[model samples]
Target chain A: MSFEPRIVGFLCNWCSYTGADLAGTARMKYAPNVMTVRVMCSGRVDPAFVLDSFRAGADGVLVCGCHFGDCHYVEGNHKCMRRIAITKRILKGMGIQPERLRLEWVSASEGARFQEVVDSFTEEIRALGPMRLKEWAFIPEQVEAAAAAHGE
Target chain B: MDKVKVTIDGQQIEVDDGSYVLEAAKSLGIEIPTLCYYPYMAPYAACRICCVEAHGVGGWSKIVTACNYPVWDGLEIYTDTPRVINARRTNLEMLMANCAPVPVLHRLAQQLGITEPRWKTDTNYTCILCGLCVRICDEVVGAHALAFINRGAKRDVSTPFQLDSESCILCGACAKNCPTGYIKMEEIENRYIVHKEMNLSPNAAITLPFRQAVPNVPQIVRENCIHYKTGGCMVCAKVCPKDCIDYGDRPKFEEVEVGAVVVATGFDSFDPSPMKQYGYGKYPNVISSEEFEVMNNAAGPTGGKIVMENGEEPRAIAILHCIGSRDHDYHKYCSRVCCMYSLKFSHLVKEKTSAEVYQLYIDMRAFGKGYEEFYERILDEGVNVIRGKGAEVVPSGYRQHEEGHLIVRCEDTLIGKYREIPVDMVILSTALEARQDAKEFGRKLNISTGADGWFIEAHPKLAPVSTTTEGIFLAGACQGAKDIPDSVAQGGAAAAQAMKLMAQGEVMMDAAYAVIDEAFCSGCKMCNDMCPYTAITFDDAKKVSVVNSALCKGCGTCVAACPAGAIMARNFTDEQIYAQIEGMLS
Candidate 1:
């Protein structure tokens, strides 16, 4: 495959996850480049998880959550909101495009809004090609081996 | 039948030989004042108010009641004679003495120039003992609910023991036929007598649902029909020239097989009674949009008059919008069609009546073609467009009140001031809500509904009419609140979509589901928590995550979260997505 800008999306189960599903349910067509990963809540997404996706050759990372209030797990989405801000700063220090990381709010009912957010985010990521963090990144094999051993 | 000649007021008239003198006089255009002589029943001349001079054929003359006395050949009947006038006067004076000066008795007394009664009873009563109510109960209705109880002065019309008779059907036939207006019907406990425009029309006992109802037939409201209750009044069947009225017809359920089903069950207008502030059911002239629409209809109970409950033209009319919609406590979703229809109501009210129209709405969503222009037109016509929700409706409680009998309280958001508009009528443009049994109907069709109970479509933009079910479709307000044009377009689209399903005859769904490579799995069980549907389970013996394909929604969340690269989404794998991403960047 030619050089590609792979993007990863971590969507929360209650709000953003259903919101993207609502986009499909609402039939709001948009760019289909971003790969989605669903979690129980936005709090479950770690900053290391965003780093890991980039290490696995993703050019960008998008974290989605419920609107900024007491969310799925009381303050789960709020915690995610604060985490993404720090993650963006860290990406810039690591010689990556800071704009590659984005945090968006998509309620369960805002299907058209989700489509607009996704389309705009995809365009921004496409402008900055492959992350190339993989040039000096930690290997997936090493991380998998460590995780499997820890389970045992 | 042999005809006989008679002289009434020295004018010769002919009639059927055994016909009553009242009929002959009526044929001669002479009106004889009579009571207790209902033509439908045998004339019970309890009140001999139609007395006349009848010179018999044998040269002997006597005074007789014209209502029951028969005319004979050479019979000289004089209705205007002094003797006839005196006799009628005497009979009415006696009735006037017995009963209270009711309007019916007073009108008859005025016709005879009787200033006052010669005698008076010690105790005055309402009933003249005309026996019309009792006769109708016994002879016509056959309900026998009302009977002459006691004797002489103490006699009155009453049901047996007067304690909510089990046999009393509450049919109001006696009340309708009672001429004195003394026999009024009382409301039974649980059964509601529907008002003028609320259910059907005021005359819903027998009416066509509308002038253009398909099958073009009149239906008898069995609940209101007297014949259905007492099995006595076949009046409609008797009077109908075509004799089409059938008391035997009953509703029957029929079933049919179809390739596809279209659910366009429509919507019910939101009832504003639940919001106690509106005072819809608690006050007069506060009407729902549906009731107002019916009232505007030419064939409606008021005959298309935009009048107040007191049967007078309204001075000012207020149209309140969004009764149960777009409110945090009631329904959070916009009803979507209220703003446009409220504008239309203002236009109609302006057209039909000289009443000043006021439109109170939070937001005017005139989002359709010419809808904005229509709003502009109403504004030009001097409709007061207050940008706010109507808060409450109450009686105006003013002194000089031929107009402005009710007051509408609201905050004008545009001007940022509290406003209370006094109006004679308030029309609530209530929201359109999903039918009460929409969920049950959705379940029967294997479809789902959104949180707001609108049927969830497969995709709104692409398949707006198709439901989540394979061959089921949705149209009109059942999907969401929509105006007439939108609903019509959706109805046509739904028909076409259902047609396409029937033509295909079978379904074709995507088979893209996540699968695990047995050699690659490291058995960490990390992917089990990733499935939102709980479709993945770990096989204890194999020590690997197993995905039930039937339950998988193919969202690919588990595939991306898999640590050991064991799980990959089928058809649209990570590698395939990377290829598309490459093309997008290029």
Candidate 2:
């Protein structure tokens, strides 16, 4: 069967969630690979959620909110940006591709843009194939050696 | 319960013990005239307008002011007897003589059946020694700017030293309370005189904010108002049809609890004064886009004629875009409205005046719907679209009538050469910046601001309107730079989000709140201080820290900071996090 990436999307209530609703209202066709969880804010999406999603066999995770200055909760997106940046680094250390996690800003008015983002992200994840956790065993020395080999 | 029986104006009335005679008479619906007896103020008893004959001890009747006189058991008060009327009439005549030309005193005299003052003085002083101004200044306002100066016949109200007192805040409280209107405030000779520098139409000191909004809603500009600055000039109040102008109106603070909050406090236009190359404030003809907007408005200074400060229409106009915007020196982000508004200005200039228009911009960004079409239409209208950032606006050295003419210097990058376009008026398309109070507002709401000072939303894309703080949302320019349509759409979206939450009836809090292990707790109170939301409270009697589930956001800051390992975040405990990592690898 063709790889259909199972992506967990944490969408903020104010901007990105509305953008998705707009996409649905507009009937703009896009990939249905992402299952959205409505969060009050992108800032509310703890790093643990992303880790938990990966452990639960999700191929990819998407965190979406308002643009930088356009955050509904002023500075919440900034905290999201910082936390996601750190999470990406941690993902890289864990022998996972940082590309598995994505943070995007889709304004409420950008319905078309939201469709484009989801389609493109789903395509990219499909090309990377599924993340099967049962195959890889975590050995501290081997992981360190692999990280050193990767120069990370 | 002892009650005092008092007969006022031939009507017997029962009153609470120790009630004043004025209170007793008021209970019986008997009218007692008073001037210097303001509510919540100490009675001065200066006017004596409420003089009434009270039956005294020894079968004698003495006239006393009803406002200050206390009622006693079996007291009989005559408000309008022949003796009382005569005494009141005599006092009214004396007051009329002292303040003859004053309208309020004249009205009081007419009511007392006195046509004119019986006694005349050479000075013709309007002060009746009511002492209302002096007493109010000291007691109510706390300014103590006025006092009863001199002694006996020479005693009059004056500020200490009779010079401009430094303590005077010029609140106009004393003038407002003056009974006879004897304290004359200096009136501006011509309040409708136009601002000289800008050459704009004359605006009343207190006038409607705009012609479109409610026609009669007047706002006072306290800085330019003579009444606010010098305790003079209440001409606007005197002429108002509704008599709604109140000098005593103070800012009132109110608190309200709501499920959601939408902050739409808009943006501030960037001032181009700091950009000396623009010569905005220094040159009379060089103006901001807002000034141009006003000049283009039909009800504006020149009645929508786009004329120069000297009242002459410009022969050529140069509109500069991205002023203090899209540059590392000022704002790094492109203020989205400037490009389109500059095009609009070009069209307006061409339509209103037969002037040659030039648009100087680094690049044309027509990203919005119908915006690119608008740009194309402006091009069709024969606007000279220059592909370069205007460097400097300088005075044209041409000798013949060079007053309004300015030389705009820029490199025509497309043509590979520098060009100096001489135009009569220069318009700067200034940037829109976050409001100066955005930081203070963010602090008040317990929300955080981005580095650029705009409110940071919960998520940049998904949660555009929602703040980090739940139940609060942002709309319009408060979030970022947005045009009217976008702002309105955001407003509707925010409203809908709030409605959705309200319709849900209950908010589902995160199940990851902190749980305290009471057995392992050492009774140390460190987590209480670490909680940013004040969710952790140390129970002094129980010697344990309690977590408020509703208030806690499950950030795990307290969990990590706990010394005893007593607190564990629900669903995010150390064991759960380790298990997730183990599951990720195996």
Candidate 3:
């Protein structure tokens, strides 16, 4: 089968999720490869969720939240940023391609930006092909080792 | 109140008569895992994690949720028996099976020794049917926005009909109490987050005042407002408790008659973006002092935390003084407030943050009362007061940390050497200048502006507040750069002058008002129309225009507009102008 990147997006309900809704209402066509999972706030998204997405056969993961200072929960996006930064660092050390995980800020009014980000990120992920975890058989040792290293 | 005997985990404890088993267990130091139960809220038995085996007086034994089951006389409760553990484990397994990805559920399962879930994994939902949010929103907040929708496995908590409800206050109480973090309030409060990278400030379209001033009014800035820009997003109007918001409100104009006017229009902060060497607009951390003041304000973006753009507390800060002020290439005059405010920044930075502050200045102009004492106090606080003008702020080459530091390049005049001080933040104490519309405003008020564009005072010292125009006065920084004390003094002086003018029943008129020659006057009505003050009126019977001396200020517009050459200003007649020109030529 031709390679189609499976991109999982964890979108904060206030900004990015609403932005996606705006994109739909505007009938802005973007890549259909990306599927979104809505969360209350970006801060609610644990780093484990991003890891779980990759483990569950997602080729790419996108965590989008409200812009800085624009978080619905005052500083939720700020917390999201700090956690994502740490998660990216952990992903890099785990030998997983850190580029697969993308964190962006999309406000509620940025419908065009949502379409653009989705299109660009989908194209970038398509170029990278399927994630290594998806192709490899369930190797308990390697997965456990990677998880242990990330836990540190 | 009466006490009741209750046995929790086989330990007999006396509790309030109406207390639940969970509270009685707590009185006897028995631990019960609770997810949906909160002390401030009514007991919600949605999460059955606190299930316990209860024994009745009639020798009946059964499993009951400790959160809602009431304590009674001679009631026995078992919290950690094999049957109770099995019951709790079954409940946790069902929760884990249904909400597999929720970290809180997984944590609770692990704590209860339910390492592996027996049922099939379902990742479709994260909420464990915890009704804390629903209960709190309905009971405490009084906003019945959320409710349990659907039934059984397909059940979910949502706004009625899954539509954006009008009753939602966007108070975020539901989101705050949600154990699974599902109900985001972003839909209700559609505030666009502006300037994300810079961490500058947070603002809504229609916002309340920053400080406690009289009337503490909220105003709408149309440009950034969503309703004004896109004709959408009336969330502010919807959420307002008093329903006081009116999107239909328009700008209004009214005319008022006054004997005197006090021009207290203040100055504007100089924009330093044009000074590329400062790296103000380019650098994320290099901010103006006004922005710093907001950042330091308790009600500001970071809630008064002195953090850099990237959320790191600055280890060192450099306060640059005399930016765009006291420079011949820009403003020629010293912005009198910069030096003191720069010192204040130094004191605040040192007090708030652990940052080592460097005060860069051309000279310390602490000339006001107790100002020198404040300067000495700041000096005692270990602030590095350097005598030098900051040349430029550039990124430091030291990449010791992930975030690069900024280096302030300046000549240390005291040491006669150039020094590059690395700091995380640089606050530019920019100069205050006349508002861009000062000239137009001066012209509209018929007041003379100085060569520097400030409103000219009648006299430099004796009549500082009075303008060249008889009935108008100038106050505060509009006339010159002044600190709070001087501005307040000038305001008082201007108010007193206005009150003095109002107190006088009659005012002396200048002897230079326009006069109409009835013999040569024609009733063309051109002069009457041309008079700005409406001082000239046409006489229909005499066919001549008459001048109202009391209303005229001798502008002589009617003299130029008169087609018959019949109007003449008393002091500015043609013969007097010719004499003045002749005298000037001689």
Strongest candidate by DockQ: 1
| True-structure lDDT of candidate 1 | 0.78
Q: TM-score of the B chain in model 3?
A: 0.68
**TM-scores, in order shown?**
0.59, 0.54, 0.56
lDDT of 3 by residue, A1-152 (tens): 78888888878766788779879988999999888876656765567667767776778888898776555444557767887888899988866788999999997668899999999999999898888784454557777777788895
Error of 1 at B291 (Å): 4.2
In CAPRI terms, model 1 is classed as incorrect
Give per-residue CA lDDT, model 1, range B1-586, as digits (tens): 9998999988898789888998888888999887677666777877788899999766898999888898888999888878888888888889888788888888998988899789876565778888888887777777877888888768788888767776666666676667677777677786554222223553557877776789877788887777877788676787788989889989889899888898998887787888999888988789998998888888877898888888998889899988899988878888988888888888888888888999998888989889889889989999999998899888876657534488889999989999999888899888888888876776667565566777767666877888645578988999888888989999998899888877887756447678998789888888787675688999899988899987765656566557677787777566665554344334
Docking class of 3: incorrect
User: Chain B TM per candidate, please?
Assistant: 0.67, 0.63, 0.68
Best by TM-score: 1
In the order shown, the chain A TM-scores of the predictions are 0.83, 0.89, 0.89
Query: Candidates sorted by DockQ, descending order?
Result: 1, 2, 3
> Which lDDT tens digits does candidate 2 get at residues B1-586?
5798888877899888877898788877887877777654667789998899999567888999988888898899998888998899898877765565577666666777777578865566778888988887676656677898899778888889786665555556567677776664432343332212211222335556666666546677565454665465465566678988998886689888788888888899999999999998988999999999999999877789999889999999999999988989999988888999999999999998899999999999998999999999999999999999999999886657565479999999999999999899999999999999997887778665655678877777888998867788899988888888999999998899888889998997968778888887877887787666788998888889999999887756567557688988787676765454445433
Candidate 1 residue pairs that clash: none
Residues B548-577, model 3: lDDT tens digits: 899886655466446677877686664554
